[model samples]
Target: MCKKKPYLLSSIREGARLGIQECRNQFKHERWNCSILPSIYTSSSSLSLSVLSSALASAHSIFGYELTSGTKETAFISAVTAAGLVHSVTRSCSAGNMTECSCDTSLQNGGSPSEGWHWGGCSDELQYGMWFSRKFLDAPYKNSSDSDVLSAMHLHNNEAGRLAVAKLMTVDCRCHGVSGSCAVKTCWKSMSSFEKIGSYLKDKYENSIQISDKLKGKVRRKEKNHRKIPIKKEDLVYTNRSPNYCVEDRKLGISGTHGRECNRTSDGPDGCNLLCCGRGYNTHVVRHVERCECKFVWCCYVRCRRCESMTDVHTCK
Candidate 1:
């Protein structure tokens, strides 16, 4: 596929970048923070095609290790990256960047006339995106047996991620009439912003299901009472509980919360008490300097005065 559709290389790189960045953003306040070890890649060179390919391969290796761990964090990474790939590829299709796909025309000229609206514009081509993402990302686990717990969990989470993109797809419409009067509306389906997708996956991660490690011809929740509850396509699944990220574990690649900045006032995950894992925290006085009190000038320029302030910063001990 890479040789046949060389243009897709850029989209793949963009998709991986989007996924990793969004993962970090969603977990910024958490202990894990979705960080990749510096040793994973040797060089931080610019994103040439070869470099990008290497990066993607390295990411896959990392994800593979996480999959073996079978933790909730691993579930989130699988889902978010899968959704990101679908989003980027779909956007490319909508933009006519690929010869094989363009905006979805299936809904074109199809709508309820009684509602004074009809589908007429270029709806995002999510079908192609979903197909491609599955083919590329899920291809590795395709040969694994159903009883292989790690592969099953990974495949399920990957589909859940793709479903998230489809679940959040929205409709955008344009008014068509004289003087913008109430007459007809042209609507098209579009995917939500990547941020929204990331947020949704984060929520899913919070409520992710833990399946039994043994696969008896199908995946089931670990709890006996919930075994009958059918796993939905949108639900994230994992086989193992996550390790507490309070202390660094080089073997697991966790950086822990030591020296991590924390919110003194907040009671959330970012709060000093919780984030520090009851180990306590340290406070330091830091100075900040920036341009302040800016005013617009007549010559299309602005002037500002330099400002300096001292503040106390808190970090986990």
Candidate 2:
């Protein structure tokens, strides 16, 4: 077998440089989104992802019972697929300009000493991939113009799209190495994610959400609960499994789905990200919070678009 030193590869070297650039960029942007942790919002390294493919090229490497790049990549991908970014992994959707790069999504051998390597265990990989995806997703890159960021912000709704962006953003890093390579290391995913109230969130979702509506709703949120748990002005959070957003708002619920009632605020303009949620539709509000938007008559849970402008229903005529 031909033995080569790790630094011999030119492509890897260039990737390392790019990774450094990304790290520097992330350092700069996190200043504005001060509350958003770079680690939780970003992926670790593209160089690692590339190295994974090379390691997978040979089956012998898998049997070596050592930590190979492919095994690391595979295990991490599997964990993320199952527990982290399940949305993107399950759909197998490709981004608009994706260059056909693909990854293996299997991790049955993750926990075994005989089969392959371990990043501790299933939950660990899930957490690792969760953090990995986040770092890339939120990492600031010069690859695309700021306009792309604004445009991609809309893509936040699509789990696969976010994953693709993450993958692409880390391409240079993967080519390089993990030594200070494109690592922003935000503590976003490091902390335990808060619970997701799936059904509870849907019940509170407001429809036809405009920028103005967002402004008004936040104001309403502040006014309605002056004495309650104060969500700091800058803190945000997102789900660990698929569709990550906010990064600081740790407690989460599935996005864009209607479900049984609980008094949780919708996380986005479209609603869905809830601080607390429940089982199914026909949602009933919880006892602790002022339940609104129940199947019952008047629901403050579901807000109305026209009504926000209306003083009286009879006066509309």
Candidate 3:
């Protein structure tokens, strides 16, 4: 319910768009897709945003960023937001849009390189990104003693997201010799696409840690837990239990799966058997048109004929 305005509204909006789009793209195939829209009667606003107000008001609330009872959603949002911040700022720095930062030149200044290391391209602007993101995104949790448990979990998950990005940093290299001969090379630390980051976070979500109770002002797992190992800094953490998500619950922020399309052949969560929540599904035939029998013209364009196809569509009742 408390929203703080970030610096650089225009740039933040652009960054938010990138983050939201990436989240949606990553969760498209999943059941709990990252949607920004808030129900007309829901009390909780998913995201701490202020990320995209116009779209939010227009009914596209997007990935909920606020810490909720649902640990999975909270973990994902925190990670995605951090990842988004890193992705956007790094891109902006490389693109020369921001005046405050520029291409990473740390390696060019006598930094020791390991074997097979040719660090001479624009290094990933992760340092700047992490700093700026910490300042911007951590504003809400700073100077607050109340909600220590929730705040700690969120902060941990946020850092976990950043760590995910760092873990995925790769050495991007290109040969600089004529005909690609074995000569000089250019390489830089590059980040994986946001989709990959999301997938990684999804795995983290599946294996998220549960905070049984606060121990000496720190989160501790319950003994006798299946995951007996100590939690890693990169692990996602949650305090509250999640809902079943079988029916609509506005306060819980679950829209339910009714009327949602399901794949009949799929055996996963998206399968009709599971998605419908044992309520059964309704099927109907849908017709669509497509371009077919296209042939390339001499050296110009090509023409194609229209073709019609029909397929069965299934939706949860």
Candidate 4:
């Protein structure tokens, strides 16, 4: 069995789960929905609902191992993993659960002493979290030279993920005063919500860079006219083309749109027309009972009445 890292296994598991949840939350309305992870495999016997051509099966198998290298998938994974790492580390540190690290001391205060403000709160140690993330995540790919397109792509995407966190760091401040007088202010740098980071990374994934081949240990753009343009360290890079997820195919590891919930009024990819791959969908009525007419109680609790509602639910055929 392989030995674990310096970190606790529970922390690692929590971090991974948080990251995956962030990805799902960001992609909840998108076509891919970040379900490509954990490996969506369909066997020939299990795919009786949709017959798979032999050629398609072979193509599917090729893509099974290639998920880690896929451009969009790689971008999502990297961003989510980075976000989760920071979230887990910072929270753990703040809760006094982490023994190795605590609040940040390196973060600088913007307002001068003569001005009005200074950094004073227990700032989240993003640098330590980022350093730990880089060391832990990049360990497997460290020995790989830049010439290896796959490793190069993963590293670049991973860095992009970490950068997303760094780019979205926000400043939170509190006012200190006597009575109504404003005297001084204390501020600390904090991370933006994971949702925001995930959304930002999703945009990056949509606009990710496509590289054809490596030249002299460097990734070059696929377009000949853009070959001279060096890839940015902040941008995500992918070497392989993504497969169409419209249909279910075990070989390609695609979970087709059949039976997937869709919006009837939507014209986007999540709409029934696009999501069902033009195969059509079935509509069914769903009844929901939710708490309604909520009122605050004397102490603090809320009292509510049950209300019934009904709506049409559409599923791809």
TM per prediction:
0.92, 0.18, 0.83, 0.81
Instruction: Please state the error at residue 89 of candidate 1 in Å.
Output: 1.0
Better of 2 and 3 by lDDT: 3
* Best-fitting candidate, scored by TM-score: 1
- CA RMSD (A), model 1: 2.3
* Model 2 segments more than 4 A misplaced: 1-126, 135-142, 152-317
Query: What would you estimate as the lDDT of candidate 1?
Result: 0.85
Query: Model 3 scores what on Cα lDDT?
Result: 0.70
In candidate 4, which residue ranges exceed 4 Å CA deviation?
1-7, 36-66, 107-110, 144-147, 289-307
Give candidate 4's root-mean-square deviation (CA, Å): 7.6
By summed lDDT, the worst window of 10 consecutive residues in model 2 runs over: 308-317
lDDT of 4 by residue, 1-317 (tens): 01444444445555665666676687666556666323323653232212112111121222343345455775567656756776776767766777777888775655566767898887777776777667767666676554477766766777888888888889898888898555888888788888888888878888888887554567778888988888877787787777667777766556777889999999987889888888999999999999999999999899999999999999999
Best candidate per lDDT, number?
1
Q: For residues 64-146, could you state the per-residue lDDT of candidate 2 as single tens digits?
A: 21111111212222122112232222112122111232232243333333432332211111322334234333243223454
Per-residue lDDT of candidate 3, residues 169-222 (tens digit): 888777766787746666777888877887888889888877865645666775
In Å, residue 57's CA in model 2 sits off its true spot by 23
Best-first order by TM-score: 1, 3, 4, 2
> Model 1: which residue pairs collide?
none
Error of 2 at 144 (Å): 2.3
The deviation in Å at residue 101 for candidate 1 is: 0.9
Give the C-alpha miss distance for residue 98 in model 4, angstroms: 2.9
